[model samples]
Target: MNAIQIKNVTKRYKNVAALHDVSFSFESGKIYGFLGRNGAGKSTLINIIANRIFADSGEILIDDLPAKENIKVHEKIFCMSEADLYDAGLKVKDLFKWINRFYDSFDLDKAFEIAGKFNLDTNKKFKALSKGYQSIFKLTVALSLMVPYVIFDEPVLGLDANHRELFYDLLLKDFQHNERTIIIATHLIEEVANIIEEVVLIDQGKVLLQDHVSTLMEMGYSIYGPAKEVDAYCADKNIIGYDELGNLKIAYVLGEKTPLPKNSNLSASAMNLQKLFVKLTEKGGI
Candidate 1:
């Protein structure tokens, strides 16, 4: 079943259109990558889904019911946005307690378990923790909430390499143990590439592409050869992007079974989510 459904949702800030007729459905028990560059409306879309902001027009449904201003609907969703929601004066343990009260599915034991893994001091106030630890605390709360749907907007912003890997590991493990829809918005596309089952590319307040990760990669092909030869070979194909280095050139083309020049070296390449996202959002529209 679709955990959330958005239909013709539009949000505007005076003259600027933050989101334009955005429509999509997020299914249950799948990990989705909400990808885009800076100012691509990824955060705006997520905020709307979280019901933290109201859309100028259109409807959003959680569990097939309108979600706006619905406390019950909001209870089932957890959003760990870049914006800090914890009180700076509150101790880590106190913050967890507050969250536990707010979220029905919150597991205090799980939160403490994750915190222990990170070596976070429960007695430290939120403001006293380092940036990385702050993020870890937020992640701990979100993960332990075990809500039906979790939306993480750049949750790994200040995490180090070790913690980043740990976060992904915990996310996958939690998903396997408890079925829930997870939508993660992050610039670290390569790190989560293998874990995500689906990809959603949003640009300029619109969704450019949404597809299974494997299927999308299958449609991408790369050609590498002499600069001029690569260009000539990709002339007729729909090239998503390319790079030129001295006499060598590599071009990424999107298609299913396209003829290539015999002189050029062509191979079916797996698309890097980061590279594909950069190419698609570079033009602003897609």
Candidate 2:
């Protein structure tokens, strides 16, 4: 299959299991929101796929080729992670040149073009760039890659609002022109809600859910009304969490929403992606 398939992948650090029997696939030619809260094993999974770390059990396959330390699949995938893997003294343009030579799929001209769009100073050393500009440089490199599968772990970290929006716009434009599998591992769910076609949510080192964004949105909703009335309406529903404001309450729920009782005070509203993610991953009982 032309996809990144992970089968029964398990990873442990002494007593802690970063991932446990996790199985899922990121299909070809789609933008996926790889979402999870902190310590949800997102980074662990990405590292494994990028061949930075090995899984204790199972395997990672990119289009049926093993990804673990395999050079053949290296050109097929690119992971732009939070870690600084570049030399600090290298100028932005020099680093781009280096990466261009390292990866057959990298486009040097497009990398420079993207840097221009972000107003990134290609002449400046990486260490001299501000935190936000550093992120811009990284984004530039990732956007220019012509690889089939690209994994972006916090791709917009330290970016300002304007630059972030520009990145999103450029990303969409790029995807529209040349379709590929884009796995965006990010915390800003709302920012990516419209960008991602599918979502794979992980929690507590396990796969919580993986579905089309539209379907997940359709399945999640909130019921709002007086505390007692809302509670009553949610009694038979799949309530995930709740919120209260004085006498009023809001119940975040999964499953199809039914019409409220005739003339009842209860009201239903669609749950946004971020809210749904928060409720689903919150640690305590709700």
Candidate 3:
């Protein structure tokens, strides 16, 4: 296992800066949630890491080695995304064979086992499988790799409820058994919140915050009670967001939770990841 560092990485699309000097490190043997809203440069950063696209400035290093079209670096990391990479003329089984040829540690038997579990037919051509099945096949391929890092971009893109749950279970099992670095970039914050150890929240084209999930969760708490009391309690504190209905109120406060006044009706509870994400991402709302 090795660490991947994105040092002052910057990318542009004509005038729009996709990634604006983004810098972060993904440690070994942990799962990281690369989160952001639509057009938030999450995909740009992922693509740069995979060497699918180049960053106009800065560097990406894997274990201190430059990852600029470096074969060794590429071998250590595998990205399974929505980009259709498989040959449409080849069957799923054939594609697996081709992938096995490229990756020496690719477990063919395990891939087939996962395929059977996902109810994906191996004999079907790439173009013949449904969207969900295609996602299942790619996810199976990702699970079968014996690399140090595995990245999933929209991993459960078209998966149903049961399959999504099963995939999460299997992914947790795989991570526990092999202990590799897994980075999942997805919009489903609530689903992967518990699975990831660290959080990287990006907005617009820059990183908003990056820290341990527990630490971020501790940074804020939700206070609820009567509307006036809640509003008064949050006035001096760092208020991230709030919700009000008639006389009821809930205010999410960042920084530190202040002591309530004597005989106050306000109560405080830990804020959830989804709520935090919503509060932080809202434009000019928080």
Candidate 4:
């Protein structure tokens, strides 16, 4: 299969397990929202995939080929990490030149073009740019590369609302032009809710769920009404979390939503991506 398959990958720091038997695939020609809470092993798994760190057990495969320390895999994947991995002393343009020299698939013209769109001063040393601009610079390089699988770890970090929107717009436009696997590991779930076709939610160093955005949207909903009615309606349902206000109650549930009892006072409302994420991660369940 043309995908990045993570097979029973495990990582630990001394006694703490960063990832435990993590197995999933980032299939080709799709955009994935890799959602996870802080310290949920998102970065650890990403680092393993990028070969920046080694997994304690198991392995990662990119398009059926071994991913770790493989030069061929280097051309197949690009990871835009939260940490700055570039030479701070080098000017942005110079760094672009260096990346161009390294990756045969990198488009130098597109890099400059994106830099222009972001108003990134290519002449400034990487260390001289502001935090947000530094993120822009890194994404600029990632966007310029036409690798089969690209991972963006917190791509919008430090970016203001306007810049973030611009980045999403540009990303969608880029994806529309060229289809590939784009894995976005970010906590800003609602921001990429619409952009992502699928969601791979991780919690407490383990995958909580992996489903299509539409399926999750359909399966996750809230039942609201009098506490008694809500409780009655939610009985035997996959209730993930809940909220209450005096006599009223709201049950956040996962699974096929059924119609309310005939003319019942209870109501079913669709749960948004952010709400679903919060509810599931809060309860770490169903």
Model 3 superposed RMSD (Cα): 3.3
lDDT for position 227 in model 3: 93
Per-candidate Cα RMSD to the true structure, in Å, reads 3.3, 3.3, 3.3, 3.8
Taken over the whole model, the C-alpha lDDT of each candidate is 0.86, 0.91, 0.90, 0.90
Cα lDDT tens digits, model 1, 90-199, are 99999989988877799999999999998899999999999899889988988999689999888888899999999999999999999899999999998999999998
Using all chains and alpha carbons, the TM-scores for the candidates as numbered come to: 0.85, 0.86, 0.85, 0.85
lDDT of 4 by residue, 198-218 (tens): 999888888889999988788
Task: Give the Cα error of residue 240 in candidate 3, in Å.
Answer: 6.1
Q: How far off is residue 239 in model 1, in Å?
A: 6.4
**Compared with the true structure, what per-residue lDDT tens digits does model 3 show for residues 1-286?**
3699999998999999999998989999989999989999998999999999999999999989999999988999999988998898899999999999999989999999999999899999989999999899999999999999999999998899899999999999999899999999988887887899998888888999999999988878889999988877877887767788889998888877778888999788876677788878999735
Candidate No. with top lDDT? 2
After TM-score superposition, what is the CA distance of residue 286 in candidate 4 from its true location, in Å? 5.8
User: Alpha carbon lDDT of residue 28, candidate 2?
Assistant: 96
- TM-score of predicted structure 1: 0.85
